[model samples]
Target: MAKKLSRRLQELQQKVEDRTYQPLDALSLLKETATAKFPESAEAHIRLGIDPKYTDQQLRTTVVLPKGTGQIVRVAVIARGEKVNEATNAGADLVGSEELINEIQNGRMDFDRLIATPDVMPQVARLGKLLGPRGLMPSPKGGTVTFDVAQAISEFKAGKLEFRADRTGIVHVMFGRASFSPEDLLVNLKALQETIDRNRPSGAKGRYWRTIYVSATMGPSIQVDVNGLRDTKLAA
Candidate 1:
């Protein structure tokens, strides 16, 4: 049996026409449809032409949203000696070494982002089973594994997002909150588009970009004009 849509969701869906819209117009519609009681997140769903099953075709990287993620990002760090203090001084919400690993093993996931120093990764690797599925594992490519723990914590707290293409060749990311202005959301979306293009896999074939869509967390998806988004240039 198909799950029934909420009355609010049904009404919101009706407002979205079946047509691709310009980036700004799509974002505006996204805002208009975000009528949830709580502040909903603004998200982007992009389909790319690549197969991650092949090593060379994989796409995994991070983008810094200029307007920020519009939520408090709790950061946890697993480090040793000096790096632990560095993480703390940099405003890490939680900091520890072995004890931290043990806590996560016992199912304490209080933080949104986790960072670890390079030297501690071997030990941190033990928690992969617990963290990988939840996207909490510290990865060098994701900029969560570094000796400069302070900088890593600072960047993540300031809206640095790690994203990758799923098995279906689509990238889903939350760029900001629905409470943010459409212009602010557009800035973040543009950054995401540029980042995806910049990190295009060497093995990806023709027509790398398939489609792009944006929506509020509880709202209907709005298709975005791929060509229009690509042609957009923001002022320096």
Candidate 2:
């Protein structure tokens, strides 16, 4: 059965017309429609031409949002000896070696981002069943599996985000909060666009960009003009 839309959501939906909007205009509308009592996150849903099922067409990478993600990102590190201390000194919220793996195996997920050193990855691989579905599986491409644990933790805490095209060839990411100024949001969005373009897969053929949309966490989706977003240049 289809669930009914709330009265507030229904009214908000009416305000959005059936047409695409420029990037800035779409962001402004997204902010305006974010009338929830609490601060809402700004999210982007992008469709791309590449299919992720093929190895050559797969896309997995990270982008650093200049304005920073609105919420605090709790970082966890799984390493041994010196790397463990390195993570702690770099402000890791939780640091452990085998004990950390055991905690996660028993369903103790206390952190938002998990960083595992290269030496401990063999053990970390066993937790894939628990972490993969949640997009928490650390991989070299995502910058999560590395010898440089401290730098990885610092970057993730400072608004660095890992994203990839799903099996359906769509990318979904949270850029910032609705309370942020439209300019800040635009800067982040532009950065995302550049990152995706720069990471275009080898087998991606024909038109790479399909469509782009932005919306507040609970607000109606606002279509962003693809070309307009691509042409947008951030001020130096």
Candidate 3:
């Protein structure tokens, strides 16, 4: 069923134009259209021209936004011995070895991000059934699995995010909150665009970036002009 729109939402929707907007203009308009009582997140939906069936065409990576994500990221680390202390001192929300694993196995998952050291990966492997579908399984590419637990914890807690293309070859990431300044949102959005452009798959053919759109959490999406940043090398 379609949701019932509020008067504020109806009014906000009327201001959006039907044409593609520049990155800066889209961010500015998205903030203006935000009608939610709470601070809504500003997200970007990027469509790519790649086939997910091929392993080489898949894209999965992380980027640390210049302005941190307004939401606090609760991080959990799985390590042993000194590495546990390293994660704890680095401000990890939860740190453990076997006990933490057991807690998760018992259907207790309190943290948003989970990191595991290489040595304890063998033990962490048991939680795959519970974590894999939730995208919480530690992976080296996403920087969620590493020997340097401290660095991983600190980076993740400081707004480092993992983004990967879905089955339809689209990458969705929240750049920042709607309450952020237009310049800040643009900086984060451009950083994400650059990261995706830099990590363009080798098998991708012409027109890598198919479409780009930006919107507030509960507002209408505004199409972004992919060609608008051609001079800055954001051409697709």
- In model 1, residue pairs whose N, Cα or C atoms come closer than 3 Å (at least 3 residues apart or on different chains), thus clashing, are none
RMSD of 1: 0.8
Instruction: Please give the distance, in angstroms, between residue 126's alpha carbon in candidate 2 and its true position after superposition.
Output: 0.9
**lDDT of each residue in 144-228, candidate 1, tens digit only:** 9999887888889899999999998999999999989988998999999999999999999999999999999999999999999
Residue pairs in candidate 3 whose N, alpha carbon or C atoms collide under 3 angstroms: none
Output the lDDT of residue 110, model 1. Answer: 97
TM-score of every model? Answer: 0.98, 0.98, 0.94
Tens digit of per-residue lDDT, candidate 3, span 117-189: 9999999999999998898999999999898888888888778899899999999899899999988887788
Better of 1 and 3 by lDDT: 1
Model 2 scores a TM of 0.98
- Per candidate, the number of residue pairs that clash is 0, 0, 0
What's model 1's TM-score? 0.98
Per-residue error (Å), model 2, residue 103: 0.9
List ranges where model 3 is wrong by over 4 Å: 1-7, 230-236
Tell me the deviation in Å of residue 194 in model 2: 0.3
